[model samples]
Target: MVAGVLEVDPAEVTDESGPETIPTWTSLRHLQLVVTLEEVYGLSFAFEEIRDVRSVGALRDVLRAKGTVPA
Candidate 1:
């Protein structure tokens, strides 16, 4: 799902699932990403939440904390 948001091949996602190597995650992509994530997870993130999310793992953590992601 993160790969889809980044517009990259899912295979390129790392085993550790970090965001540092996600080339599409520049500042310009942030808003689009947040919107996409909101749709995917069915939850709206506050501006501060979006500001604090820096990585795919972090985003997943946020969704998990919100109980939005299906286990």
Candidate 2:
């Protein structure tokens, strides 16, 4: 999903991948990713949670906290 939003190869994305590491991860793309995740996971994120997610690992952690993904 991150790769799809950023238009990058899935293999190019890692736990540490973020706007700083991915040239295509513009602010707009980040918003799109958030929307996509919400739609796909059927869960909403708090403003602080959304703001705190800076990387794939962080996003995964949020999902884990929400019980949306396996730990």
Identify the candidate with maximal TM-score.
Answer: 2
- RMSD list, candidates in order: 2.3, 1.5
- lDDT scores in order: 0.75, 0.89
| Backbone clashes in model 1, listed as residue pairs | none
Q: On a 0 to 1 TM-score scale, where does candidate 2 land against the true structure?
A: 0.92
Q: What are the runs in model 2 whose C-alpha is more than 4 Å off? A: none
- Expressed as tens digits, the lDDT of each residue in 1-71 for candidate 1 is 66776788888866345456776777767778788878877889998988888877677788888987633
**Each prediction's number of clashing residue pairs:** 0, 0
CA shift of 26, model 2, Å: 0.9
lDDT of 2 by residue, 28-55 (tens): 8988998899998999999988787899
Model 1 quality (TM-score):
0.76
Which residue pairs come into collision in candidate 2?
A: none
